[model samples]
Target: MSDAQTDPPRQRRERKQNADKRRRQVLDATYRSIVSNGLQRTTLATVAAEAGLSQGVAVFYFKSKKGLLSEALRDLYLIYEAHWQEAVEAAGDDPAAQLVALVKADFDPKICNPAILSVWFAFWGEQKFTPQYGEITREFDDNRQRAIQGICARMLPDDPEHAADVADWVDTLTDGYWQNLHLFPASYSNRRACNSTLRALAALMPEYRDQLTPAD
Candidate 1:
């Protein structure tokens, strides 16, 4: 192949990798900035400093604080969704196992890291500044709720309505634990949280008690 043809494809790949790297760097810095300074206090300059990149570069990529925050929120939601989805898939075909995996995934270190969790709550707590935050989070919640509801339906073949109720309870318990883990790290244990969630699952669906026991 001609150098021009071969070089263009290689250069394009390199450029894409570099662009992706820079975007991830900024997004990570955004998470750290929000965790450290709170969402309202986070700015392009703060993120740039955290990223060791110039504010101009941050601006070039994300345009403004609003844009940056929206992207960061979306990125974090996608990461969370991906983790649980992967966990559920790994749990095989048993609906009970899938439900257990879903609860455990919420506390998985990859998605439950304090810094990332704080960034989520920061965006969640801010109701007025950006509607994008609400939109992104609602999408995440809706999808996760559907996944849980589906699993509950499979587990509770006789009563579909009760399945939904159990799903709601499961979501509420996991969310409460997440808040506890974020707000009261002094007394919170991830293993305990997972155990508590599994216990609640067992109570909700006693028939599946054997399957709901915490694996850890």
Candidate 2:
């Protein structure tokens, strides 16, 4: 009832909001720094500068360089996963359409923007040295593979093994696209990559192609 007690509660709420804001700012700054300078050159000071905060402030939220990097990678994974989910949903009830949507989603510039792509490569480059990086990368890979497998299974129920084969095929194609995008810009245009993936999927399920339509 007293001013002191009420003030403490109000202050706590304000602090919580401020902390959340700061955490987001730090994560975003870390992402941008990794995108611009590559993860090897990204530092707390550099990220802090990007966030318009002091290095101490960045450390206050993330604790250490490794912690900052991990959180940034987690954020990136979450965003990527969400995009995949949306793509799956947009595919509607048709399994064939869903497969196409899945392939198209990967190359969508809105979802796989340059910054996100750069940060992804940076994380991939660091996975060799960081155990957590490997763990997170595997988690993403497994989840994606499973999702693709599930879609294939629904589309080709009569051939369960074919579903897995499709999943593996798509995975390989996706990786190839990523590599080409990183290495050869002209050869891996987004439209070309997406179309290639769709064609590959169509080849895998030629019988279902006529039934499938472009996802809304």
Candidate 3:
């Protein structure tokens, strides 16, 4: 018999909520551990210690280090995807506004902080050895690319090839900015990176230059 079957409805709801809270705590600790210790050095014990939970509890929730790390990657992707999706939605139906929103979303503090970037690169560094990491990252990349491509297509209806190319360039530009921000934080600000990306986008698609002007 399951715990839910034996427990009262209120008790079951509380139990599930508590379980979710603990699980999220573990994942947050996992990100900190990755940022502080690197991916290979992060152990279940370390994460549990960081979360103020037991190693056994970590195992119970995630089964193994691989399971824990995979879920962490998925969680990060979900956070990233949600930010961009919300940005696009808030930009209304204008493709230009949506494109700008998507670009700006990459620099949002919640998704682009040093700890999150560290965790992301840590997973990316292990993609060759970890197939699931590659799978998760590929999905992330594909989804973003499709969104960019769709927006570009809407803005440049007669030139589908150019739309695709601009989408690819925008993705690459955002990635380059992330790499620089991660490695050269002392010299780079998110503002500069975002403005530079917008400039590059305007140069690529001069038709949208008015709409793609970098905010001051």
Candidate 4:
């Protein structure tokens, strides 16, 4: 194909790339706005300004404020899903190590830093906003819980019921630790938050705590 024939495709590709870039720019701005202004006050105009674009651009992509917020929530959930999936895969075949990797992934500052957690709590505190968001977490957590439960069962073959309970306990403790991070970030840095979860995991399964904790 000559340049004349190929130029149109190139132009189309550039437009698509710019559109994707803008979409992410707007979403990131939305998150920053929510963090700075609180979700209730984060207007589309504010998001556009934060993104260094006009409100018309944001409207062009998301159509409305709800759409932008919904996409942000979906992106957040996908990020968390990827982190844990990679962690589990990297743990090789040891169920104990895999479980520990899963726990550590939850508190990884790259994905679950205080700023990010605050953004999540903003969406979580507003039930009205949640309905607008997709159900990305439902199946994600279900599959994760099942994976952990199966790992626990394997580790404690003699006591399957206790293993099941251990899985549930770990998730509950994880939630508590997350809540602590959101509710008390000054006192509970991501490191501290993760350690709290690890400590609880230790108390629950002492046999694998050493494997879970890294050597200094």
TM-scores for the candidates: 0.94, 0.88, 0.97, 0.86
Per lDDT, the best of the predicted structures is 3
lDDT of 2 by residue, 1-216 (tens): 865467878787897899999999999999889878889889999999999999999889889999999988888888889998898898788877777777888888976656677778878987889999999888888898888888889878889988888879987998788778877876668887777777767777888755432332
Q: Which ranking of candidates, highest lDDT first?
A: 3, 1, 4, 2
| Candidate 3, 134-186: lDDT as tens digits | 99989888998888889999999999999889989998998999999999999
* Model 4, CA-based lDDT: 0.83
lDDT of each: 0.89, 0.82, 0.92, 0.83
* TM-score, structure 1 vs. true: 0.94
Per-residue error (Å), model 1, residue 44: 0.4
| Winning model by TM-score | 3
Better of 3 and 4 by TM-score: 3
Backbone clash numbers for all candidates listed? 0, 0, 0, 0
Could you give candidate 1's per-residue lDDT for residues 1-216 as a string of tens digits?
775466878797897899899999999999989888998899999999999999998998999999999998889888889999999999999999999888889888877868877887888888566778888888889999999999999999899999989999998998899899999988997889989999988988899999997766
Give residue 50's error in model 2 in angstroms: 0.8
1-216: candidate 4 lDDT, tens digit per residue: 776466788797887899999999999999999999999899899999999999999999989988888788888777788889899899999988888788889888888777888898888788545655436556567877888898899888888988999999888988888888888777787777677777777777778778766543
The worst-scoring run of ten residues by lDDT in candidate 4 lies at 128-137
Candidate 3 lDDT score at position 102: 90
Which regions in candidate 4 have their CA more than 4 angstroms from the true location? 1-8, 213-216
